[model samples]
Target: MSNFTYRKDHIPKGTACNRRPGFAMKPTTITIHNTANEKSSAANERAWLTNPSNKVQASYHIVIDEREAIECIPLNENAWHAGDGSGSTSGNRTSIGIEICESGNYTKTIDNAVMLVAQMLMERGWGVDRLRRHWDWSGKICPRLMYDGGTWSKWYAFKAAVQGRLNELKKEGVASVSDKVTVKAYGKQIKDGKLIDGTVYVPLRAVAEARGDQVSWDNNTKTATIYK
Candidate 1:
């Protein structure tokens, strides 16, 4: 209900691409990926980024390793990250992609990554239900052991994760969920009347009844209505 401060700086910058002339690309499906390494160091991950012929010429906007983070691409560009469904973003450009740099027999570093992604989603106006993963679109084992084993699709799982992150963000004081309000209370509610300007007009009798107060007014004397 109140205003919130969303820092654009909260998101990172994107990689420059000569492949396209604009950053208006959008995706319909999200893709999940595992960086296949445990070292979360940016330099370590950037080792593969410097190459143009790596075939994996795509760029990631964010990389999470432990508590560390890196901004590899800006949000406006079409990251060449995903393999199959990435052809045209209009159908999938809105999708978010995440690559956690821990893979192959490594422990799950997904906790932080998941939380961050959830917060990012909430901030982006994308509800938790829309959150998805890379494996949802492609057949890659990508997320691998960290991958979903449930009957729900990866997108659903991502949504559930977003819900969890919503809770977490609420707990952290970084987000708020409710926006209901009341201007008057009577008859167990504001059913007697509504708010007019900053003042709420209610039937005096109804209010008295709501508060267990009886009302009686002397017509001739024009006396006050008294009910309690």
Candidate 2:
């Protein structure tokens, strides 16, 4: 996971533009978009959305650039992104909008977005299948970088990267070695390990057996031996 900074700068509730006041969102998927403005940073996008003078109705949950990720709106609220009209299944109502800023190093910006999306998915217990492009909701050619000659190779690659990070996060959740430790020996998984004080204690016999080794215990000497 990239060490990208994150902060929430939410647009005021009941804002005349950019957000829906009474609509609550239960995000089922994540929709990706490109800011389409090359000169604006993620902070700039958040400021624009929260500016009272801004008349555009477009808003998103998060904006990510090479340096940081700013949340302009609460994830539980409906953003006016997704050109599809408000409906039960519309992207605006069912999806979390993520706008990737086009300024700064494009590759690093994308990497940060990938890490953010993977973390979001891991929190929600979602898989890569929940990822969506703006084009999927409407016919708009949004997140233009991910589309090429009517193909979605870049989008596919982005999803693959998110999945890879998510898998790593999931693995990190296992065998924490805090209160207890879960061990995976070769292809076998063992959860018979415990953490005592500052040391981790594991069943030597179980671990040896998992590695296909013959373990012999001597009660007289209180010793154990492993035969390879």
The predictions' CA RMSDs to the true structure, in order, are: 14.7, 12.5
Q: Which window of 10 residues has the lowest lDDT sum in candidate 1? A: 1-10
* Distance from true location, Cα of 202 in model 1, Å: 42
Q: Kindly list the per-residue Cα lDDT of model 1 for residues 1-228, writing each as its tens digit.
A: 112221111222332343222356443444556776665444456545654554544555556655454545445445555555445543235554566776332333455566666666554455555644555555566665455564436545545765777776666767322123343445376454643211355677766777777899898998867655
The list of candidate 1 runs beyond 4 A from truth reads 1-22, 26-30, 38-40, 52-55, 89-92, 103-108, 148-161, 171-228
Worst 10 residues of 2 by lDDT: 172-181
Instruction: For residues 7-93, write the lDDT of model 2, one tens digit per residue.
Output: 767778777763756487788999999999999999899888767788888888899999999877677777878999889899989
Residue 145's lDDT in candidate 2: 86
Task: Report the alpha-carbon TM-score of model 1 versus the true structure.
Answer: 0.54
For residue 46, model 2's alpha carbon misses the true position, in angstroms, by 0.5
- Alpha carbon lDDT of each predicted model: 0.52, 0.84
What C-alpha lDDT, on a 0 to 100 scale, does residue 50 get in candidate 1? 50
Whole-model alpha-carbon lDDT for candidate 1: 0.52
